[model samples]
Target: MEMHIRSLTKPDGRQLRLYSRHPIEHVENAPSPFPDPLHANPHMRWHPLRGEWITYAAYRQGRTFLPPPEYNPLAVTRTPDNPTELPPGDWDVAVFDNRFPSLSLEAHHPPETIVPTMPSTGKCEVVVFTQDPQSALGKLPLAHIELLLQVWAERTLQLGRHPDIQYVLPFENRGAEVGVTLHHPHGQIYAYPVVPPVPGRMMQIAAEHYSQHGRGPLEMLIEQELACDKRLIYRGEHAVAFVPVCARYPYEVWVAPIKAVPSFVELDEEQRADLARALKTVLMKYEALWNRPFPYLMAWYQAPTDEQWHPEAHLHAEFYPPYRTPDKLKYLAGTELAAGLFAMDVLPEDKALELQNVTVQLEEPAHA
Candidate 1:
């Protein structure tokens, strides 16, 4: 049987060729602006990277996952005098593996416990963007923000050398409403022996796309988006940041290199620095939205250490936050809890324009 695909343009203008039997239903003002569940949005999305299309449809639920207030307690707090205990100050970007780790670091195939016996060894790290009690990404200086970007690239290269690790996912979480467990300005990394489901699905779809169409998925996306510039947030010599047409989250921004490269280690120094500058610029814009520490989840996508089938992989990063208005936020409800489909209320274009900005105040330092 032949597979049928439907091409559609999202509200923001990201071109999508959704795989389906019949043509996709295009509503006049669908997902119409209202208080909808998170799952109502696209379960996954794709873009041009390296030479393939990567899918992360199932992760849309993550945008509005239930909040466990217990995670961020209000018992005793830590002060500048002692940061290791109770609470932590906003910090310079710090890198560390995930503790509530979804994947293990070393394969211990001894007995049965939570998950089936699969050697799921991976790495997770956090990058604290500031050291102030009240500081957000937009409130950081160009120097400090640049430093954070440098650290992200440097860490990606360091983890790519791990023999057992296959994929390295560096991401951040902000805003208590977004279900952030910790209040610090930080992001995390997950280096796994196998690529996650989302990226894997994208690689699979790209395989089909490659067999039928002779071009890279992300390559095409870059060309198409650059030509339109509707959702195009910013473009640099090596990178482009945009809010995808079918964005699952309220304000979702993806930034990736124009040319397909699967790993940060493959990026030249100048290219890496360019990425850093772009990151700082974009993040500062995120903070300027509400002048508070806006909650966000940022991640860097790179090749798995085991460079097998790398032709199917592409490299990029993203920032997806659920905060709709400065004070208003999107919450996860029943539909999203049971099913994986996401429902976004506001249009992607308005959300991106609302969040994107250049004016911000930096967090104070010792000299200040």
Candidate 2:
């Protein structure tokens, strides 16, 4: 597959990222003309959450890596305790409203009342962690990682309480491989007026699982995974982080509450700290294996708190790092793009053990 490099610039003069493309689909083993309704096209994107599908067959021409326009620069930065100066405290993890939000906090989302409408009405914020530009969570000390987890749990809890807000999505975009523009150690929160699709589908499946098996779907997965011990990444007291049984990526890791709380924000102080330890362990392992800046997207899924609709939503985090082979990335091509199915090269069991047994040295902190 051919590779190309591109860049997207922010108004602040900071280039958000350099786009290095890789052929997601390798047809060396497939038949000449792939025959299936799923592969009717070469590349397409189904915007499940937005209820739309976009074809990227012309991805090679000119629209490969055009970055979206900058939204609110003011919202991306921190709101200092004192408006006249920089933030006073040194924060390892912090939560703030996302500047480039796909959703908005609708003061009042009265039933459409228009011809065309999309649910861009929600809230999103960026969670900036250290002032340093190149700090990754794995590099942070265990104590700092603990504090960061605390911030995540707190934000989820506090944001979930809003009468207008339904779901709180806390996610982080790491490395250029995953389209993460900034090098700063930070994440984001999207407080939605409605539950997003992935979680929504999960809620549907979970409800069905509960009705049929008399237990949560994730509960079923945790049981099978723990006993199987194949995809288990890190098993801690309060939480269990592991790659999924049918992993979609090379080293995709998920963190779930073992106690089966409805949401992550519901986790107590101790549970939050345990989550921190488990997460740090996963990132550290990934770094050790890759040995460089291992990139991945870390996302938290919570039950959208509306007046009351979705009942079976269980909170969890998804890590979808595109890096399958070292320096190689998995792009969403024909299969994932056209069809909903996902294909991965690495075995989950092997990746799990590799991450579990691997270790790394923490970077020393700078003295103030």
lDDT to native, each model: 0.55, 0.60
Best by TM-score: 2
In terms of lDDT, which candidate is strongest?
2
For model 1, state the Cα shift of residue 231 in Å. 1.5
- Encode model 2's per-residue lDDT on 29-56: one tens digit a residue: 1110111211111222346666742323
Clashing pairs in 2: 97-125, 98-124, 98-125, 98-126, 104-122, 166-305
Q: Model 2: residues >4 Å from true position, as ranges?
A: 1-86, 90-92, 106-115, 307-311, 360-368
Candidate 1 C-alpha lDDT tens digits along 143-172: 565555556556666676777666777776
Cα displacement (Å) at residue 61, model 1: 23
